[model samples]
Target: MEGILNAVVLFSNFVLIPGMAYGSQLALGALGVTLIYSILRFANFAHGDLMAFGTMFVILITWWLQSIGVGIDPLPTALLALPFGMAAAIAISLLSDRFVYRFYRRNKSPAVIFVIVSIGVMFLMNGLVRVIIGPNDQEFGDGARFLIKVREFKEATGLNEGLALKLSQGLTIAVTFVVVIALFWFLQKSRTGKAMRAYSDNEDLALLSGVNPDKVVIVAWVIAGSLATIAGTLYGLDKSFKPFTYFQLLLPIFAAAIVGGIGHPVGAVVGGYVVAFSEVTVTYAYKKFLIYLVPESWEPESLVQLLSTEYKFAVSFVILVVVLLVRPTGIFKGKVL
Candidate 1:
């Protein structure tokens, strides 16, 4: 029983909880990518930078709220400032559509053209975020730090292993659940969402059936912007926000989207968990976890990790390459591109 308990605790601490939280973040980010690919029909390479931009706004607002003596007790004030960040992100997305994307869209440019333009947009947003946030890590989460303290868990369970649940982890999972449910509801039931789906299915058919292409594009961008802000803010709260870190996140985010099925929302969510768990499980030093489970004489000397933490991000890329080579349609039958 003691061995079993220790094993459970080990898995929870190193794999289960962290994977779920990180999966939630990736799910949200991948959902945004999938939405753009579904509706706009191009990979929005600018998405990670958009997340950084939105998170930058949230950090600023959170700081302002803290300065003014306004806060949510036991919860991060960043949560309250989230809506403002989302709004700013939406405005920027709309403006970009009007000024930048709109021109290419009007010319009926090829998908590659849009992808290239998104790369340019990505650079612009990256530069803008760096200028505003100064390329430094910013910690904005302010409130109760842990929902469950390690000592409290150890005492309650009378166990050698203690489980610590951070507030940010709980918040990330909860928010992701709420957002995902709402998104699925919108996509599966709402009229405008149906129009978006119809547009995605066949552009000419959707237009002939009176689905307004412009309205669909606007709705998709709005959803993408809102999702990017929430995902970015939650990530920053859970970890620390750095402009470059979000840029790095693009690899995993895109990998999740591609692995799950580029244009499929459900695939995006599943792919997020897949990528997250793979990264954690592959890189985690399992020597300690194994020691508690194995017989005393059988203990191993080495860390027994598959890869170093420095190569964690590469896990996603490797998975992505394998998935593309094996099943480009992803787990779902989404467009290969």
Candidate 2:
């Protein structure tokens, strides 16, 4: 029984908790991508860099707040600075829509054109973020680091293995739940939400039924901007923030969005967990846990990891390719590519 408990603890520590937190972040990012695709009819390749831009704002504001000696005890000061980050992200999104995307949209340009434009936007945003924040890792999380420390858990349980829960992990899960609920509620019950859905379902019919196209577009960008900011900030808190890391993050984010069915919000959320768990489970070294469970005589010589940590991101790409090949519509019956 002690061995079993140890195995469970080990698995939970290395796989379950990390996956959940990472999943929550991916869900938020995927939701943003899905929303823009559904409403605007284009894949915004710039979305990842946009997240970095928003997170940069949060990091800056967090620094300013800390310098002024203002902080939330037990929680990271980044939480307090999130709103400012969202505001800046929203402003940039709106400006991009107005100055760059608006012309092509008005001209009824093909979706491919919009995609190419978004790639250009992605490069610009990536460069802008590098200029503002530099190309290095930034640590903005300051306060209570863990909700439950490993030593405390081991002492409390008198167990051979311990479970550690970080404050950032708890925050990520809680904030994601609240944000997702609010988003679904807004989509289901709010007037603008209905209008947006109507527009998504059929733009000509919605326009004929008195739905304002411009308003729907603006609302989509606003929601996407907010999601991007929250997801990026939460991830930076959980890990460390580096501009290039976010750019690399685009692959997983896009994979999550596509895997879940590109235009479906619910699919996006589900997809995030799938991708996160796959990545964690595949890359984790299971040698220690196996030793805890198996007899000493039967213990393996090598670590039982399927892939190295450096290739973790590649897991998402492989899954993406498989999903695209097997079921292009994804798990949710989303729009077929």
What TM-score would each prediction reach against the true structure? 0.99, 0.98
lDDT of 1 at 18: 90
lDDT tens digits, residue span 1-337, model 1: 7877987997898789999999999999999999999998999999999999999999999999999999998899999999999998898899989999999999999999999999999999999999988999898988999998889998999988888889999999999999999999999999998999899989999999999889999999999999999999999998899999999998999999998999999999999999999999999898988888899999999999999999998899899999999999999878989
Alpha-carbon error at 134 in model 1, in Å? 0.7
Per-residue lDDT of candidate 2, residues 218-259 (tens digit): 999999999999999999999999999888888898899889
Overall local distance difference test of candidate 2: 0.94
Q: Pick by lDDT: which candidate is best?
A: 2
* Residue pairs in candidate 2 whose N, alpha carbon or C atoms collide under 3 angstroms: none
Off by over 4 Å in 1: none
Model 2 residue 195 lDDT? 93
**Positional deviation of 114 in candidate 1, in angstroms?**
0.8
